[model samples]
Target: MSVISEEHVRGGSVFKDISADDDDWQPTEIESLCMNCYKNGTTRLLLTKIPFFKEIILSSFSCANCGWTNTEIQSAGRIQEQGVCYTLKVKTKEDLNREVVKADSATTRIPELDFEIPAFTQKGSLSTIEGLLDRAVAGLEQDQVVRRATHPEVAVKIEEFIQKLRKLKEVENEFTLVIEDPSGNSFVENPVAPQKDEALTVAFFKRTVQQDIQLGIKADDDLDEEPAGNDLETMRNEVLTFNTNCPECNAPASTNMKLVQIPHFKEVIIMATNCDSCGHRTNEVKSGGATEALGTKITLHITDPSDMTRDLLKSETCAVIIPELEFELGMAALGGKFTTLEGLLKDIKDLTVSKNPFICGDSSTADRIQKLREFGEKIDKIIVGELDVHVILDDPAGNSYLQNVYAPEPDPEMTVEKYARSFQQNEELGLNDMKTENYEEKNNVPAVPGGTE
Candidate 1:
């Protein structure tokens, strides 16, 4: 029996070079029982280091007789000490080129698509922002819920959302990309951003007592410590609790309604219902504020990596445009999110990469592939600080915001303009153009004498 030392494993000397020929290879003495056939099988462990992240162990097992094969990836180092959330705006073609490292425990969501790629369902991957959205689109296409939708409208909506996601990759659409990891192992890289610029907002918050226990952290006397904040106080004071019938089992269920305030956005009324009898749970969000009237357009020039750090808040009613890139993102192309410029670029790149077939799949034309490659290279150059671009946000509802950290003192590279809405734009806002009085007039009905007594 051979003893495997912790140092040997951590130092990554347990595996042979993968590039060597099979005949020239000297197999490590590692052996394990085949998971499928219960026969002794050879195991190979490889160590690979990822830039800006940690080393990982890629282990493979093969049953020589039954031909069973399996591969697994495990982190070679300690678990992350804190959780992380990455919010990215997908506003331009360059934004789509950002690199993303998603751990197995990370959850990704594109609210506009009404799509969420939950943790544990996907293996850890190091891909571009565009690759991530492509995976989400693929998942939606194969989802049992979408495939077996009973209602035609539900199916149609799902298909429409998928199309929107497809459009998001083109330079013509915008969306918000968010990733949350409780383990703090995931990352969305902003390589072009300056070192001093906090391009990525790293918000640190204490994990729940339950989460700490699960992670094997020793608990102290402060386990019962209360969270202090206006938000908590509001939650405690405004929680409206009642009993309701569960939709799943028709059993009596408890419901709680509260007004929750999200930072950088208006308050939202959240209603949550849970049934203890049938294990049913549901939650809904509603707007808790009035809408704005005037339209707004925010323009910012991206010249240096530091510019990518600027915060952006794009409302659902906003349309994003990059005139130089000849791309425009219409309203509701993506849901609202608070993220940096670099994050947004990553999302667009990921979406565009995902829709390559639609973009240039007809003929095996070299010109088409070359053009796509050139376009991708241009985006890559922008991400690495070699190129500059302009980002514009046009919101008819005046709800979008582009953070100017150096306020009072204007940023020379940014411009904000407000304008009156046009006739069509005002109509879209559900304003005075609804034409309620024209129904009878259009149908050639004369005014009913004295109101149709």
Candidate 2:
């Protein structure tokens, strides 16, 4: 991350490139108000699905009255679980020409120049490093006339800075371009991606509470200005509704959360959201209690169709494996899920086949697609009890659970084991850095690696 000092502003950027387009898709043409001409214009909207990436909406507007035109791209994917930061070393002319996607929720910086572009100050753009610099230069030059007249002293400083910025376009020196996106939507292109572009580095980190508020994931202020305000505090069962923006459409919506206890299990938080704008509904289950002393591993031998109805809770830290099918899903792969055995299997199928957006545009191979489809078919067979398989759920937090059909009788086909978490697992969970013994005994807190004290 670059040290923030001075920030620049730029207008929206537009890119006309498409990695790949769905062969069978059609675009929608509609009449809309034009921002430039203030007259109705023709807006063409196409929802494009990338081979191995989430879908995006490509829209182009043209006004007959003023010959005004504009093009923009909007991601149609869900909000990623973790935010991402991309740092690119613009050491050569090729690096400057690489494509970049700057989400509106991202912050951009030129570390060498000590210049930053705060999030939301500029619109989202699908452009390159050189284009980004060009846009910045244009925005600064736009206000020079007024600045030179009203504030000549400050204007002189800006003029000198502008000249310095233009010199950067010559690639006479190397600089780092950093983009920190709390929304995890920004991108810096690597021409030979998957092969490791030495000039670029990418990292994902947890979003801050302030970032969550800005993204409309949570209410910035107490939303309870009504009689039911005290319900969430006083009543555990009462669903607490809070205003939030829809993750799908970024429109006003509400998220409802409730604490519910599972029989023979601990209480868990269930959150559900319904977006009226796009009619998209999403629900996630999260453990409500503190971390357990040890981790948990549960294995279930599925041989009957009735097993499909068994309830399952896969914690966020759980890794799922099916030895019979030679399948493995790493931790946080499916997130925290509360669903039935059949539902989980279906989700696995959908994710591994239909929704695995990592095809990398044109690099997707036919064999890979066939294999994914075959995996989905195998999962369907498992749901129908056509194949017997052992499903293992390993959770480092000991927060996962599987409903045993036999319950107190101890389902003969199910086995549960408790074991201490490994050091690497503890480090990943930040438990290694936590001082649970005597936190009050410390003076000025020291920062831990990858975390604050």
Candidate 3:
């Protein structure tokens, strides 16, 4: 991936008046830089709740050097001052209207803030509260206790305890507390104790208020009603059964058979169907053989554009093009030589003056190739001071034969059998397989033993 540059910030303002970007909207480098500048070091801005297009940015910046923290609330937009300063309530209609216009429509709704603990409030022991609540609920069965709590007076006490738990959940520091009754008697046996402030165990406490308890009370008040019976599976099955039909023949389709899904294409295929009367076996989906949705088997041809020897053979020379020339070079890492200069030259000369060539060689192969190119009196490959030559072989009908070959690797992670198969399919062509009445004499090859059958 490329590094993000500064241009992103300049264009971000265009989107400022628009709705807030998605949370997953990965910021460009310049946009990140703009956000950093907006922070101004003193306060951090957390993107929390947003109203429509406006984002609720929570800024809390802490200085490590001085152990100081500063927090600010900003309406997320283009980070402009006017867009961020509309939190104060307006006193008059005109003021409200003016403030409304300044408020960012894209601002996300802020989540409800929980109760805050007052700094001057008497400190309470978290462990003490937990122990007290645990002791209070210990003897009672959770289901039965919650059922009893449905009474007005009991519910009020539980709600009060719940509120205390909520406040306890908000405390950030660890501290111990000692409680004393109004009679001046200490509550705890030991005065001093070690404790860590923890989030109020509200979920555990909520379980104390059980569903059975609520259900019993709901029953007592004649408010309980039987839940609707669920037959979702049967309904879904009926819906699926309704849709199960062949478009072409209106036959019942089998759900047991799995269908092949080709990408970017639509058509439910039913394979191997037999028509009783017509005795015709057919596939359900149309044979969209060359559809764009169906992946194509691409054939590539890599060639030097400058080669003209093949064109000369087709136009003027009597020699017919022998398109297939097979030259098998053993695998590289087996300490086997890929190609020899004489072998390469012999293969090129043996061609019917029309086939393109595949030239593979060592780093200093140009000198060797130039000598081979001289033997045929043909302009074959451009010696670009490279060891390899990948040429496109094509018939006069523009049927390309040769595809691409990657640069030779020290240890190509392919089996020799696979390499051999690829060679037979892609690179090699049979040039000697061609026939002419007097071609044998011109090429100086011996006559066949069985004569011209």
| lDDT of every model, 2 decimals | 0.66, 0.77, 0.28
Model 1 lDDT-worst window of ten = 192-201
Expressed as tens digits, the lDDT of each residue in 300-348 for candidate 2 is 9998999999999888788888988877765665678889989888877
Error of 1 at 321 (Å): 30
**Best-to-worst ranking by lDDT:** 2, 1, 3
RMSD of 3: 33.3
Question: How does each model score on TM-score?
Answer: 0.39, 0.59, 0.13
TM-score of 1: 0.39
Give the higher-TM-score candidate: 1 or 3.
1
Better of 1 and 2 by TM-score: 2
Q: How accurate is candidate 2 locally (lDDT)?
A: 0.77
- On TM-score, the leading prediction is 2
Model 1 RMSD, rounded to 1 decimal:
17.4
Show where candidate 1 strays beyond 4 Å: 1-45, 59-73, 143-156, 195-200, 213-453
Cα lDDT tens digits for candidate 3, 1-453: 122234533433212222256433232221121232343233443443322223334445554444545444443333211111112221222221111111212121111333222211321221233343232343233345565656766766655655554443334423222221111111121111011112111000011123323222224335456977847545333422122333222244433222333333222222344443224333222222222211122112224332222211110001112212222211110111112223233344543122212122111146434543453443233222122333222222111111113324321221111112223322222222435568788889888988977
Candidate 2: the clashing residue pairs are: 52-357, 52-358, 52-359
* Superposed Cα deviation of residue 440, candidate 1 (Å): 62
**What's model 1's lDDT at 442?**
85
